[model samples]
Structures are given as C-alpha cells and as structure tokens.
Target: MNASMGPTLQTQGFYDRSTGTVSYVVWDAATRAAAVIDPVLDFDSKSGHTATRSADGLLAFLHGKELRLAWILETHAHADHLSAARTLQERAGGRIAIGENIRQVQTTFKTLYNLGREFLPDGRQFDHLFADGESFILGDLEATAMLVPGHTPADMAYRIGDAVFVGDTLFMPDVGTARADFPGGDARTLYRSIRRLLDLPGATRMFVCHDYPPQGREPCWETTVREQRERNVHVHDGITEDAFVAMRTARDASLEAPSLILPSLQVNIRGGQLPEREANGVAYLRIPLNALRTVGSMPARHGSA
Candidate 1:
C-alpha cells in the first residue's frame, strides 16, 4: 500500500490513440501478481488484418516488471476497439472475465444480427462472468466488480483496492462521461451510477478506460474522486438528478454514432472474441445495414472520432 493509505497499485497504461482505448496492466508491486484490464487487439478493417502489437506492448511491460498475470478483466464488452484478451490469456496465462449480464447483451445482439442457434448467449464464451458485488483475490490484492450499467446493460466497474477502473461509465473531469444512447442505456440509471462512484471514499483514485485530450495533449487516466466531484461538467457535486438527465439527453441527441458501432457490437457482445470464422478461413463481420436505422439513429458517443 502507498503511504497515502491507498492500495499500492502499479499501473502501466498502453494507449492506442487511434481508437482512443487504453489497455492497462495493474499489479501489486510487492507480490509481482497482475491483472490486465481491457487490452486491445489491433484490427485493420480495410485489410482484414488482426495483430497483437497492442497486447504485446503490455506483455513486454509485464516482463520488464517481472509480474505474472493472474486474470484478464473486461470492464464491459467494448464498442470501440477489438479486445486482445484471448491473445493475452494465451501468452499471459489467466482466465478472461466480464459482467454476468453479458448474456443479456449477447442475446439482444444475436437476434439483431440474425445469428444461428449454435451461438450460446449464456456467456460461456468467457471464462468467468462476474456478478455484481463479486470479489476476488489476486495474490494479496482484492478486486470487486460493481454493476454500473449505463453505457450498456452489461457495463461494470472494477474496484481493485482503492482504485476503480470505470470503463465507459465516467471519464477524467475534463472529458465528462460516456453517452447513454446504446441499446438498453438509460440516462437516469447512468446518473445514479455516477453518483455511486463519486460516493466512494473521497480519496479513492479513478482510473478511467479512455481519455481524449486536445491536439498534441497527452492522455491522462488517473484522477481522484474528490477532483471529479468538484469539476466534472456533467456530474459535478451540485448537479441535480433532473439536470444531469436533461444535459446528458440533450448532448446525446446531438452526437453521432460511433464509427465502429456496426462491427463492434456484433463482436464485442460475444466477449471480445471474434465471430466464428466462415468456411475458407475468412472471419465475416455481419452488418445489419438498415437495422440500426430502424432502431432509431444513435447519437455519437465519446471515444474515437
């Protein structure tokens, strides 16, 4: 533990500014045991190429620090970048985990994509489906999964020690929070979730999943609860529930959908693993074409251009 009374969390962030997704390797320095949160797999949609460059960066960092990986945790099925969890698990030796509600997400998307009966929506694709309030130990470190579902029905925030890795739930103060316009997203519920996170001990540190600063600015992911409470534009301490909902709703309505949304949802909802490869060894990504239009236009969310 740090002298400041915070858990001794050694975190090295590997940011893919292209997708604006941050993959983290966090460990307890003393025990040399680690967990990787949301590692990215570099996918080239144009060339249909998939590479492990992003995850390899994390692997190299872990080797440098001499830490053994204990678990691979996903904050939620991401909608922006492909997850390298499977590749990392193969190289790092740990089981993959996600929120139990992923089954609900998978079932919803599977039907939208018209996937066949062979696909099981029970989250069996993942090694572990963490329930809300579930706690697990990593060597001496304790990590708790909190259901903070607003970005999607299956969103989760991992509270490891005093530092919480809030996926799309909230961002650094300057960036505001994630949009609540995806399937199953509710602005009111998101507000409550943000409040719950802010209520954590005033000193608790928040490690956000992504950060996008202005041109030439470096991405910053670590901030304190006290700082967010005082300065977050959308959910600062004095913002009332109704006000936040109104602000969030208005902002969401004006935004555009994520560029990768079409391809992302189909793959992410299945635990970051790609869809079953088709015959001839080609992996096919199904696009519902006008399906999203029928569901209503999606407002843009933060992350990726």
Candidate 2:
C-alpha cells in the first residue's frame, strides 16, 4: 500500500496468460467492500468451451477475504477475451456496469453480426451505465469514471483514490499504448485521452487492463503517471499529436484481428451473457466472413490485449 493513498484502498490483480489480460479486485480495507474490474471468462476457441476457473479464483479470493462485492466493472466490450461479469454476478451479487457509450458499440456490432430484434442496444443489459465524469461510492471510497475512447469508442478508466484502472488506454511505458484502428477509433482522440490520464498527479498509480511485455521482460500491470509521461515510446512528453497519429496508423495497419474477436464481442455486448440459446439449446456465435479488414492480414504487432 502506498502510504499516501491511505489505508482504505487495496488492490490485487489476476493475470490471464491465455489472453494477456489482467483483472483486478479492488476493495476498501476498512469497509471490506470491493469492485472487480475486467474479469475474464476462460474460453477455448478450438473446442468452443468456456470455463469459470479464472472468475471462480477471484470469487474464492473475495470469499476468503470476507469482502462484500459491490461492483463488477468493464472498461469496454473487449475484443480479445470473454467477460465474466454475468458469471460473477450470478455467484456473487454486484451491479454489473460499463460506460454508457456501449450503446454505440452495440449498434455497430449488431449490424455487423445481423443480430435479431431480441437484442437491445439501449444499454439496459448492464445493471448500470456510467457517463463520463460520473461519480460513485465503493465502500467508503469515492470513485470517478472517465471516458477514454481510442482503442475502442466505449473505453473508460476508473479512478478510485490515488489509483486509476486505465482500460486499454495506455499499456506499460515499454509497450506504449493500445491500437486505435477499431471501429469508431481515432488516433487523435486516443492521444488526447492518454494526455488526460497523464495529467493526473505524478504520483497517481495507473493500472493497465492488458500487458504484452517485450522479450526478456516479465509481465507487469502497474505504473505511474510520471513513468508513462516520461518513458512511453509512442507518446512521451515531447511527442506531438500528429506524430503519434502517424505512428499508430501505420502500426495498426500491420496488425491482425484478435483471435477471439467474433465470440468475445458477441458475449461482451450482452453484458457477458452468452447469446440467447437457439431452439436446439446451444448458443451460437457469428463470424462475418471477409467482412473485417484484419482478416487474413499479417501478424499483429503486439498480440491481442
């Protein structure tokens, strides 16, 4: 614990090596109330199997710690891994929530997937939808949600005490930042969003949702505003918006789509609920052929995050 952050806030990260994603359990030590951020639902594409091992581990931790679940937060609808929000909620009660801009993402994918009218894009799927700058209480801590779209249109960062969970907005300084080539993504917009987080106090703790470490370095998720602003290769202190955009655009062009994009988005948009079962009782995921530009493309610069 950072002495400056007081004794209330505590955080533990769960890393999913399969997807290179990190899920966090942050709680108020005094109140024992907690929030689970970006939990992963284990998925095997080859066999079309889903498991709760990852999420169940988190639940076990919560139970062992005697912490009360308050919120299950998603930074955005992910493209790389399935969400465990609904699964976690079924086992442990919490308000499952995400940014309100998810409606836009829902609309875009609904058309691409040709989802039926049964699905609604009104953001009702989530227990709550947070607007930019919205404030909420987690135990005794006051947390604020900040919209940080770039990698995706609905990305949000949660600021609790002195720590911020930046979902895909910025990776570790060595890894730079997330790609901004997805639908509704803009390099200029991403650069501005990154600057917003960096503007926080230099000592602010920044937690990344994903980390793809380079060779010889182990995975790490925690960094500071000061570290990012000073060492981030893509957008360091002296990097201009134009220069960053140019670099991101070129870099994203050479990347391939995430392996689980099809299944991940379908389940994620529904607040982590699998697609409604068909008459046969098996839920199906749609894959639009030759639809996404990233299909059959060259290898990704950084593997899915």
Candidate 3:
C-alpha cells in the first residue's frame, strides 16, 4: 500500500490494472474519517458477471485502519469501467456523491439508452450533488470540490488539504491528458480546464484517476502541478490552447470508443446500480444499434433461425 501523508490528511491509492483506474482513500489523520474516490466494480463483459473484489479490498483497508467512511465520491459517470459506489455505500454506510452537473449527463444518456419513466434524469440518485467550489467537512479536514469539465461535462476534482484528486482531467506527465471526444466534451474547453488545475500551488500533490503507461514504464497515478507544467507532453507551460486543441482534436478523431462504454454508462448513470430487473429477475444493459458513429459499419444481416 503506497500512501502519501500530509500533516493532517493521508491518502492511499488503489490501482486496478484491468481498467487502468485508480481509486483513492483519503482521510483526516485526527479523526480517521475517510472518503473513497472513484472506486471500481469488477465487471466481466463476456460472462455478464459482476464481482465485489475491488470494493471489498477498500472496505478491508478502511476496517484495518479503523477509519470511518464518511463519503463515497465519484469523479464522474465513467465510460470505461463500472463503479462500485452504490455497493460501498451499502456495506460501509456513507453518502454517495457526484458533481451537480451530473443532471446534464443523466439527461443525455437517458435519451440514448431509453431508460424510461422509472429512471429520473435528476441528480437524486446520489446522496449528495456538489456544485463547483462547494466546501464540506471530512472529519477535521475541510475539502473542496472543483468543477473540471471537458473530459466529460460533469467531471470534478476534490481538493483535501494539500492533495488534489484530479479525475481524468490530467494523467501522468509521460502519459499526457485524457481525450476530449466523448459526448459534451470539447478540446478547447478541456485545455482551459487543465490550465485552471495547473494554476494550483506548484507543490500540491495531484492524484489522477487513470494512467495508461507507455512501453517499458510502470503504471503511476501521482504527480504534482509543477511537474505537469514542466513535463506534461500535451499541455506543458508553452503549449498554447490552440495547439492543444488541434492536437487533441486530431488524436481524438483516430481513437475508438471505450470498449465498455455501453455497459459502463448504463450502470454508472444510475449511481452504479444495475438496471431494474426484468420479469425473470435479470438486469440487462442496452446497446443502441448504430448509435455511436465511432463504431464500425454494421454487420450484414442474416436470416433468423
């Protein structure tokens, strides 16, 4: 367990290789009150099986540290992996939260997925919906939520003490930034949001949500604003907004949609709760035919048996 410690706050990151996601546990040293950020729910798309291994590991860590879970925070509704937020809240007794802009995301996906009258597009699915610059108490430490959209319209970064949990806005310096091509994402807007984050104190600790390492390099999730400014290949100090946008747009054009986007969003938009079970008690995810242009041409149709 690799942990970074401040005078009053402590942070430990849990990286899941299957999805390249890093979930964090941050706490106030004085009270042992903690929050879990962007936890992953293990999902096997082939078998349509879901497991609690990742969430269970977090629960075990909290129990071992004698930490009380005060919050289960989601950086955004993810597209690559299922979230473990609802499961963790059920097992540990903490409030689940996401950015208030999630209502926009919910509205968009609800239309695409046809989530019907039962699923409300409002942000009520979560225990709390944080607005930009909102402040809340985590034990004895004061934490603030910063709106950092562009990777998605609802992305948020949580700043607690000297550490900042930046969710998908930036990655490790060697890996660069997230692609701004998803729904409601804009390359120019992403550049500005990243610059806003770079404005923080140079020495502030920055923990990323995902890390896609290059050849011969190990996975890493932590960096600092100073290092990112000096070394981030995509948005270093001298890279202008125009240059970043041009590069991001071209790169995003070549990229395919996330493999689990269909399943992940359908579940994530519901605060990690699976869709309501059918009459046979099976919950199923919907995949709209020919909806995403990024997907290849449709297969030739064949007669049914």
lDDT on C-alpha atoms for all candidate structures:
0.82, 0.89, 0.88
Off by over 4 Å in 2: 1-6, 293-305
Question: Model 1, 236-274: lDDT tens per residue?
Answer: 999998998898888888777776777777767766678
TM-score of each: 0.93, 0.95, 0.95
Number of the top lDDT candidate: 2
* Candidate 3 lDDT by residue in tens digits, 20-71: 8999999998999999999999999999999999999999999999999999
| Candidate 1 structure, TM-score to reference | 0.93
- How far is 199's C-alpha from truth in model 3 (Å)? 0.3
1 against 2, candidate with superior TM-score: 2
lDDT of 2 at 81: 98
Question: Given candidate 2, what's the lDDT at residue 194?
Answer: 96
